[model samples]
Target: MHLFSALAVISVTVLQAAAHGYVPLLRINGKDVPGWDISKDPYTTPQPLRVVRGTKLDSGFISDVTSPDITCSIGNQKLPPGPIQATVAAGGTVQVLWNTWPLGHFGPVLNYLAKCPSSDCSTFKGDTGAPWFKFQQDVFSNGVWASDTLARNNYTYNVRIPSNIAPGSYLLRHENLALHAASSQGGAQFYPGTFILTPVSPTTPFTELSLVCIQLTVTGGGSLNPSGLSFPGVYKATDPGILFNVYRGDAANQVIL
Candidate 1:
């Protein structure tokens, strides 16, 4: 009887842990940045908006691209600005760390950045209205994205910041689409993510005061595509990026845009 009780407890614990997955930590240039930590209830933090969790859409609005929940899932509330900010230079890399990832949930990993109206991005609210640009996206390579690579190996994903992005404060959004069960409509699992503050500045070349003016902007002349698509607007129910069959092993045909 005791053994059966222990087994039941173990099952419940596992289920509870797998109930949700989120990026609890973020790193820039190999150093940890101030971000959400799901281990401590994110709701209690100053940046509650940075704690939105994923939803199980096996039977619900998984295929509904027009739904507001499609942006970051339902029940996700916006909070006041966070006290911390991630300072990054254009053309640098940022690493995202997930708390836990379930096995077999394979699909693409996408990143977007939305410039804030003012210098303080922490004051931004809601998932819509803010036009976001697709700065970084990884599609099916070798029949899989970061899902299999991150789940089986490392839980951290390194993404490069756009080299052409103008210096400003913006909100960085990341997502993981689990398509293991996406063979049919509404079978896909959407893990919409929390938004973090990203303040971009030019990378200084030298510490000398005389060189400061010359390095006021990113060295490279590259420019980010100004045209952007809204989250709910960027995706459609029939769009190839949204609806795909990963199990068929035809990753080369997968849609990335």
Candidate 2:
């Protein structure tokens, strides 16, 4: 079976949300690893053990498609737990936990994998070049859109590591694009917005954040580096995928992946 395809199509389903959300926890092989704790990490000296590459604050996002923050999240360069942690077998699932998701903001959920050069993720920055490979994508259908994932699964979006990829240390990038306000240039959230979450059939426009990364090590997989796409170079502000009316229809053929 294609590892990521099953869970990748699913997204977070939330209710009673406010503005936006962020990644704060991850489940690797069933173990709940604390992501960057936006609420307590800053104040707590000797910061607690965090597994995922975390942003400074919780429940935030980015609107600029050209910004490097789109690669991961702001202030999310690198973090401790270095020398490899958060290991998962190939074909396993890592649950990305979004603290809060706006009921209005809706779009496709995506996941990428960039194997750290030299097998060390601490020094490798994933912002530039085409090192990031699109492995796990959502709703590859017509008119289907951002999903009701979290509400059904306890606020966690499940990302299954592709079984065919090589085993090594990788930076797992998780993102949810909010295209509710994307009718104009630069309004889409690579990093939040409004819209319907149900999957619509036939005609419609398509779509950001809830962008975050985790330093992950994959074991028991084949050897292969998939071709990748750059972040800032991936989505253009004017591109139909980024600029379009969600209520009307999608530009990327309504293919929410």
Candidate 3:
């Protein structure tokens, strides 16, 4: 209740807000679809229609690298998927829209896809043991961090759907790794977005990454299963990509990054 204490809380709140964000909209097939609107969804009698999976998010992430959350968003593993699913060609594109991204959060952007074995993305929760293949990534290029580009571009990025994958329901896992505070052992910040696709695509307690799930169904004649890395098992706290300091002013230190 003290003035100084209240001011300290305010400052920390702003800092955390500056550090992370979430997917609020998605562009599919040239049409824009609203993503989860955390503010209005809780009170609506019928949830908003969307392709992106429904999730309650904050400036939080899974730092343990071993938590199931690494598979999707925080606590997303337990939430039911959205009621709608978008369809696209196997080789289409989806534009992810971040609610907000601060220039201060600098790092890499990665994309992964995993197929839903049951063919029903709504019922499929790609948590532990799910095979996720890394299909796209934008790391440091031309002496600029991917996050920098994301912020510069209004926090929007386009992700290409794989053309060679089989037709089926899938989960797309999109991510952004913020290394701005990576000097310490557990200072990495990761933002992940999950999308369901017919062609495509945790545990941890650490506030290390932000993630979202998107629902998609792919329809096309293509078949090629991609070898993948499982979440939780995919990242480790000691890994150079998750723990090294980017302030040293150098290129990325690890491949997993």
TM-score of 1: 0.67
* lDDT for position 87 in model 3: 80
Candidate 2 error regions (>4 Å)? 1-19, 57-64, 78-84, 140-144, 186-208, 249-253
Per-candidate TM-scores read 0.67, 0.75, 0.78
What's the lDDT for residue 84 in model 1? 39
Question: Model 3, clash count?
Answer: 28
Provide the overall lDDT of each model, using Cα atoms, as 2-decimal numbers.
0.46, 0.60, 0.62
For model 1, give the RMSD to the true fold.
15.8
| Candidate 2 least-lDDT 10 residues | 8-17
List, in order, the clash count of every candidate structure.
0, 18, 28
Off by over 4 Å in 1: 1-20, 43-64, 73-77, 126-130, 186-225
- What digit string (tens of lDDT, one per residue) describes model 2 on residues 182-256? 554423333221122222332333354456667888999887778557766676656555555667644435433
Q: On a 0 to 100 scale, what is the lDDT of residue 149 in model 2?
A: 49
For residues 114-171, write the lDDT of model 1, one tens digit per residue: 6656665544533576366666666566655666676765677776777776776656
Whole-model lDDT for model 1 versus the true structure? 0.46
